[model samples]
Target: CPPKIITKSATYVYKLSFTALYTVYDVTNDHHMPIRLKDSSNSQKTRLQYASWVGDTNALAMVVENDIYLRQSPSSEEDYRLTFTGEENTLYNGVPDWLYQEEIFKTFEAIWISLDGTYLMFASFNDSKVGQMNFPWFSSNTVLTSDKQNDRFFFPASRQIRYPTAGSHNPEVKLWMAKLSNFSNIEIVELTQPAVILGRNMQKKHQ
Candidate 1:
């Protein structure tokens, strides 16, 4: 007999929209409708990067504009903001930066949910001091023209990326944890690294 291909029913399927927005669809219902945020304003939706359900629960954890947001329930209207220092490419909350993705974690997110779904932990990255590398981009349809002086000219455009080279300033990473509840009184506590990892230089720098 051929291998039995058993298919299990899924509750939700996550998807990224064409406009780079994140959406979740509930499959339990016959209509299979999308789970929308309570305040699904165009601006809010546009800033959302990704969303995922908490462990075995209807609660949702999401990242919007590099910051973290938590909703206790799918139908709840209140969205709890987690971190306040998320800046576009310089600082990231609940997500990894370019260095972390390329050299360290090799993943897009740095968020973790507790098994009981009572707490959420995430990593914040600050790459403000890292050196940047610029890349020139040209479209396939770009046309090249030569001047009478035998010089070629094209569009003056370049893409800049924060890159840390050997023995350069690395990104500062911090771990944060928050307890989840129905109320709005959420407190974030920073977790510190071990003494062995901090070493003498790290301790002196902090001092």
Candidate 2:
């Protein structure tokens, strides 16, 4: 008997099968092939948070260390860096922040690939000005004491998370579109809010 090939949900572009490993389905030939990253080191893999196929093509986009990386194919060594403002716990590209995940998108993704696979649109978040809430977290693991009468205690550690309270500074968000091409000079366009919306926001601030 032949091996069974299982596929996941179908996007606007292609039907992808993501299980233990990321696989790309070739529509033209109707076959499944495993995708491999150029950098497969543990450190690089650790930094990678999200990765997905771009449209109906074999091109791939990954969110690594809050930055966006694009490649022509899964095995391409010369990948393109779409964003550069990704900083730890401050700025994020191609992925939403905590507030957006919980309130706006209700998903972990903030990217949209064109059906033709020629363009990529994504959102960036700047949480640098947002206030962080710090609190103590008690660990579940028990530590044994070095004494005749053995005793166990849980250690408390300080935890911090960026949060936007009412009337507080919220995360700055911006939408961007990039042209996916073979050349090194990738054209990126910023999609700004309309004047009407901007004026309404300004009016609300003044009130």
Candidate 3:
């Protein structure tokens, strides 16, 4: 079967003029409509980064500017903040830090929803002890003439991100799970050694 495309606003909503309109669209049937999400009172509502839909429904697990937000249902408007320690370069929530991105996971996101859609497991990386790396990036589009010798016109911008190399400090990684009903912290994943958990089985015990 081929996928249907929305060519006009009559078929699908192309634009909307409203503040705090987080919409969810379902296109399984005809006359696809958008469900507007309710907004939270959190003053810092930035753009979403790692937005993921849970199971086969409209449940949304999203990351906005590194913090995790959960919406249990499509018609619900309350956004749940699962983790609160999401500083730019210091701490990460539901996502891997720079060290895990470079050394372990090799990706930005470090989260996975359970198969039954009742739980979510995500890794938290605390890089407060790790060092930093800095570099300069020159824009390829900006034209730099050799005739002009002024250092100010060079526009060499400094780029910085936490980079852990070799045997220095690594990110303190820990896994956490939260229930879907109230988004409560259920269990903490830990390993005193490899291939072992410090507590009871997360699957059987938490359920």
Candidate 4:
């Protein structure tokens, strides 16, 4: 899970989690909770891990776990104060999945901002056509039968994010900017001709 970020006037507090445990780390104080091993019995137990923060204090960035839905909250006591329901076939703002992040070099998946304490931004991706990967495992218990070793395999659905290879059809990219206020305005910048590279050997590269 991603840490809970609490930003005060001059300090930033991060409540990070690893496996099933959590710790508090502060940026202004330059301090971190004592590191704990996942398995004390094994000397090589893995330590908790977390994504590093990027961008300035006002526009913070972090990764969420397992392609889960995310929302903005004003306080920890309240649930997400804002819900983002993006297009039916696209990721709701944030980093792309593992493949896109590693393969396409799209590290930061989403963009957020704090304007006068009101958070806002455009963060979404459309990967409805991406391919799916699956795994097989044995069930430890079954309620319908007495067998505990029931074997099963399944291929969950996934999207193929129209990744562009060396020479492949690339999806059209569009950019938009909007304001978060009553009677807010939205500007959509359209690109009639896709971006193309001009060079000696890679003169026609499209991005």
lDDT of 4 by residue, 48-71 (tens): 222222222222223333121221
Leading candidate by lDDT: 2
Error of 1 at 113 (Å): 0.6
Clashing pairs in 1: none
TM-score of each: 0.73, 0.73, 0.65, 0.35
Please give, for residues 1-207, the per-residue lDDT of candidate 2 as tens digits: 322223343221101211133455656667775443456653332234567777777677877667888877755667778888998778988877777876778776788999988889999999999999886765453454563155556566666767899999999999998888753788999998899999999999999
lDDT values, one for every candidate: 0.68, 0.70, 0.60, 0.33
- After superposition, the stretches of candidate 3 with alpha carbons farther than 4 Å from their true spots are 1-23, 29-46, 140-153, 183-207
Off by over 4 Å in 2: 1-47, 136-151, 203-207
**lDDT score for candidate 2 against the true structure:** 0.70
> What TM-score number comes out for model 4?
0.35
Backbone clash pairs for candidate 2 read none
Rank by lDDT, highest first.
2, 1, 3, 4
Stretches of model 4 off by over 4 angstroms after superposition? 1-83, 86-90, 106-108, 112-121, 133-207
The C-alpha stretches of model 1 lying farther than 4 A from their native spots are: 1-19, 32-44, 138-156, 196-207
Supply the TM-score for candidate 1. Answer: 0.73
Q: In terms of lDDT, which candidate is stronger, 2 or 4?
A: 2
RMSD of each: 8.1, 7.0, 9.9, 12.0
